[model samples]
Target: MKKLIPIFILCVLSCQSIDTPEEPETVLEEELMIDILTDIAFIRAAKTSSRKVFDEKGINPESYILRKYGVDSIVFAENNAWYGGQLERYKEMFTVVKSNIEVSKIKFEKLKKEEDSIKKVQDSIKKATGDKKDDKKDKKNKKNKKEELEIDDAKNRAIEEEMEKARVKRFNNLSGKE
Candidate 1:
């Protein structure tokens, strides 16, 4: 009976499967670093632009980090904290992002200047053509001005006549004449 009991115990132990831990899910260092840095960039932008803009744009940073990088908040926070503790690495990553932004800004400014120059050229061309139209318009303007002057002269004459009549009536009234 004791031998049967020992064999039964051995059989039961052998039947139980040992779970070998899954090879620690290997995380790509580069990808993880990029995601952490991107989150930092998003945070900086959010600080300046405000949460209202994000909400209006329907961009939730938390969800964005998850959806884009497949990292949940906990993982992201862990990466952020780890990278943040590494000052040199954090600065290196920050510098890269800042330089990229500066390059884009320079490109945008150059394009803006080019656009402005083109607009100025177009405006000059329009003004040059507009001068010819203005010559014809000047004739109409002169006629309108002359008409306005004539109307003003008539108005003045009527006003002067009314003043004279009023003055004479005041003189008659003062002398006891109707």
Candidate 2:
């Protein structure tokens, strides 16, 4: 009977401990850190073309994280350093980040598919609308295409010029002509 009483008291205490909320600061910091890490992972994944990776466009990760969560690089660095020694907590944060990244990737791909389907429907409707409107569209499209080609040529020339400059710089450095 004495042993049973002790066990029951221990069980009650454990349950009470479980019901208590975590410290608000710890929870907030953990969530912010997880979000920042996930955003970084998404940005890195976005650099790749594979659908298996994140494919969102025009994302400046550091700025986006700061704007969305008010958690900038400095805060992230501080919290990351704080958590570096706590392996279990760090792993937990990373697991959540990875799962969120996967969920985001799937959501983005689905949205992209929907967008492509809508565009296809719009194109079909335009094609079915007859020659009258198309005549004006054709002229506009031709002009736009010409401008695009010119812009592309300029970009290529600029890139080649930069490459030549870099090569010359490298050669000069190698020849001790800094």
Per-candidate TM-score against the hidden true structure: 0.45, 0.47
Which stretches in model 2 have alpha-carbon errors above 4 Å? 1-28, 46-64, 131-178
lDDT tens digits, residue span 26-95, model 1: 3336546665566667576765779778767876666665666667666655665666656787688777
Model 2, range 1-178, lDDT digits (tens) per residue? 9999999999999987753222334334687778778887876665554544333454555677667876555555656766765778889989899899889889989999999999999988878785758887998999999999999999999999999999999999999998
Which window of 10 residues has the lowest lDDT sum in candidate 2?
A: 19-28
Q: Which stretches of candidate 1 lie over 4 Å from their true place?
A: 1-74, 136-178
What overall lDDT, based on C-alpha atoms, would model 1 receive against the true structure?
Answer: 0.74
Per-model C-alpha RMSD: 14.5, 25.7
